[model samples]
Target: MDPGGEVSVSEAPSQVPPTAMGGEEEEPGEQEEEEPTAPKKSRLEEESLRAPMDAAEHYVELRAENLKDQEPEEPEDENLKDQEPEEPEDENLKDQEPEEPEDENLKDQESEEPEDENLKDQEPEEPEDQNLKDQEPEEPEDQNLKDQEPEEPEGPEDGGPQREALDFSHTPQMLTGSWAEFSSLPENYLKGCKWAPDGSCLLTSSADNVLRVYDLPSELYAPCWQLLPEMSPVLRMAEGDTIYDYCWYPHMSSLDPNTCFLASTSRDNPVHVWDAFDGKVRGSFRPYNHLDELTAAHSLCFSPDGSHLYCGFDKMVRVFHTERPGRDCEERPTIVKKRGVTGIVSCVSFSSSRALYACGSYSCGVALYSCQDGAPVAVLPTRHQGGLTHLVFSPDGTYLYTGARKDPEILCWDLRAPDKVLFSLQRNVGTNQRIYYDLDPSGRYLLSGDTSGLVSVWDTTHCASYRSSEELQPPHLTFQAHWDCTNGLSVHPFLPLLASSSGQRQFSWPSDSEDSGSDTDLGAPQERRQENCVCVWWSGPPGASAPGPEDTEDREPAEQEVPVCV
Candidate 1:
């Protein structure tokens, strides 16, 4: 296609076989220009995101501060000369540079003949006195798998707007608890939660596909009972089945207050409405559950009046009518195919109005999908391109909050002014991606249970911006919440309680409003299960100074590895 027909064929003398060669071979010099060069602007891109001021001052200060902190680099050149394979100055010998000695010479010396045996034995002893600078005896920093590779942009070839350097992650408090078997309910992990209208009972669902009933701690607060749901699913979860979310309608049932009706959606793709009063399956449906055949339901929320239910599924947000009884496809799912990751929606939450809702996804930033037609209001993305894991709209619908693994804090945005961040709270628990968290009904409290088994509580309304260590006050709570990582978390609709779920872990935090005796009740269980103990409201010395990574300046010169063959 170009000026020279042969030019495209061979810039290098064709390595064509003898029978195929028709032209002369090109010299080695020509190969230089033909080699592919990786993009050279990567360094510039990295530098542009750093603090723009005189890095000179920072570098000098950092260097001085680390003078005694860093270990000295190993001297590889001295060892290379001594261990290189030497040859006699014989005329018949070919001109060749010496090779560096093997770092594995200790084992090689034992097998080698006695001639170089002395040299072999000495190599083994040298390591004891000389420290290898390549490895440091410290924990490696955690890195998210998603960040290992940056996907090629679908837009401009050069890529879209450049991203800012990633911010830091919060260190989590390690919790210790498990959501195992309830007295008579599911034998699997906890999956969903809801509070009774009178706060007399707590209804929850687990992996076994059956709802478990726990008596509320009390009427003045939340109760702590272990009762079985009157009605539980017969055909329970299969080897691959799971329960992702569930919710209880906050209505004074015409039937009775003792029997409140609740809804449950499973990873198996079915939604079952149950009678909270007697725990009976009232109705069931599977709207948009069949989506191209991969079914997953991540979240669900009840309408303000408890008259309707909204469910999120792979690629769809279905609005189902609870007023009617029959499960007909025509009167079935109200599907909204707004945004999806591989056509699957990740998280969805309702704002104050029936028309405005916030939804987060695997592929796109969190956006407010219109209740009118389900179109995105605006894309919520950081300049650094963070992935959103959960979305919770404030009860009044004035603020929309989102959370993720890295900045384990909550980012609240005013719905009216979409661009400004209303509040940002940093969660210093184990920073993990896909972390599970929730906000209580009032939106005044935020709870995060992370991979580290730490169920940390935050005062969302207490502070607005970052306060340095000196200005920091004691947190509301930072204690051992779970033994394994927290898979999900939620709050009682009206009570001052929190529910966290992790590896086979479903723990209900009782109301803290009661007298001092409340602590004794909670601590009794933890004390009985001491070995596998879960500490509460844990206190300790100031956190260990953050452990940083290795010092790359200690690397040995590359010249030592590649000998001067000349």
Candidate 2:
């Protein structure tokens, strides 16, 4: 093959056989015999001889086609096509050429322009930029000023001398006599009582298996010990089952009766939610255990928002949605006995902030559980030697207050340090009765009822002092409140008034021979207990014409004649 041409040497006449070259010498018969063999041999020899040439030619054609395809098409831009392609050496020489003269010329041109014109162009933008920078600092300053205003007042309100001025020094004065009393039947004594948050009504539950709502008279005022007329209960609903415990809805208000509801539980009955105005059952919740035993709620409380209801039982605390009472609670109860502390969940309190709940067990220990789960986050140590009776959280949810049966001291715990006691409050508690106690709105004073018929007030300020070396502080003031045991104690929501109830169960019959007729005489009726009544105390200024003992003598018998401490 010719290396650089379109034609190859294999196609030349010299490459043909010499016999075929003498074209006119062969006879016809000889030609016919040699024709077939000659053609076959010649064809084979040609193929072998031309294989390399054929391959080389094929490769050469492919290379030419590829090169032709690779060459760029004519540029669409005529200017680009006309541009001169500079040599590499010339480019290097151009770069090495000095640019100082050109730079000097540019500087001269720039300087010759009027400085006034340049300033004018930039002058307007300078003030705007300065204004933006000024405003950037002022914005944060203004926000900081606003933030500081509210925060500054909070410090003074929380810890300033104003809070210290709350006089725990002077003993709180009690009214001369009960301002008003709600008397239940002789067979039925007051079980529980709660003042409405708005202070317009009072709800009470009795052993008669009935819930009563009493509306306060419009003329009723605090600090007036004059006995008002016996106002009848406005609304009453009888629960066929024995009432164990009851609580007013956290959001209850007299203005909105439709939204006001109270919850009560019975021995084996479902939690009955009743409308405070209509005295009708709104809903009921019956939680069951794995053993198919009907778990009865002995103590229950509504969440601060009133959206959820927490019901405490023997060994667990059940949570139910207030709005959807009929719906099944998929969440298991916040178990209290999992950590070897086993007893009835006697009392449960939801933190005011709703971050955690403290459940007090009869085992004398309190378990703290997060709102998000059933398991207890921390098991508080058993502080009291007796069973726990009540649990309460401080307004800020930082501290927990627990009361125990026969335990004279109300133990306070810092939720942050549950293992150690923050302090203990002393009250004259000597009985197994669930002696109720309450914190005044300021949280400065704590009032508790005792078996001695005395309502004692403790200075919570002293109790909350983390630096105090004393483990217990005596009550700042104690007054003989009732003739019998004072079981219920509650502070009026807004007023300086306090409500307390006294009741006593007589288990033994008179030992006189005339009265002790027979053993079956135990079923006979005895002298009626006169102290089963509710009393309201006014702590404001005393009036000049306060009622005396003569006024109460005609109405009810005196259970005890202990002198009132001023």
Deviation from truth (RMSD, Å), model 1: 37.2
lDDT of 1 by residue, 144-237 (tens): 2232212221211112121111111232221112222432332344443444544445555555555666653222221222211222222222
In the order shown, the candidates' Cα RMSDs to the true structure are 37.2, 15.5
Name the runs in model 2 displaced over 4 angstroms. Answer: 1-187, 221-227, 291-293, 331-341, 466-471, 509-530, 541-566
Highest lDDT scorer: 2
Query: What is the TM-score of each predicted model, taking all chains together?
Result: 0.47, 0.62
Q: List the residue pairs that clash in candidate 2.
A: none
C-alpha lDDT of residue 492 in model 2: 66
* lDDT score, candidate 2, position 189: 51
Q: How many residue pairs clash (N, CA or C atoms closer than 3 angstroms) in each of the candidate models, in the order given?
A: 29, 0
Tens digit per residue, CA lDDT, model 2, 366-394: 78877777667888876697888888777
Pick out the ten consecutive residues of candidate 2 with the lowest summed lDDT.
150-159
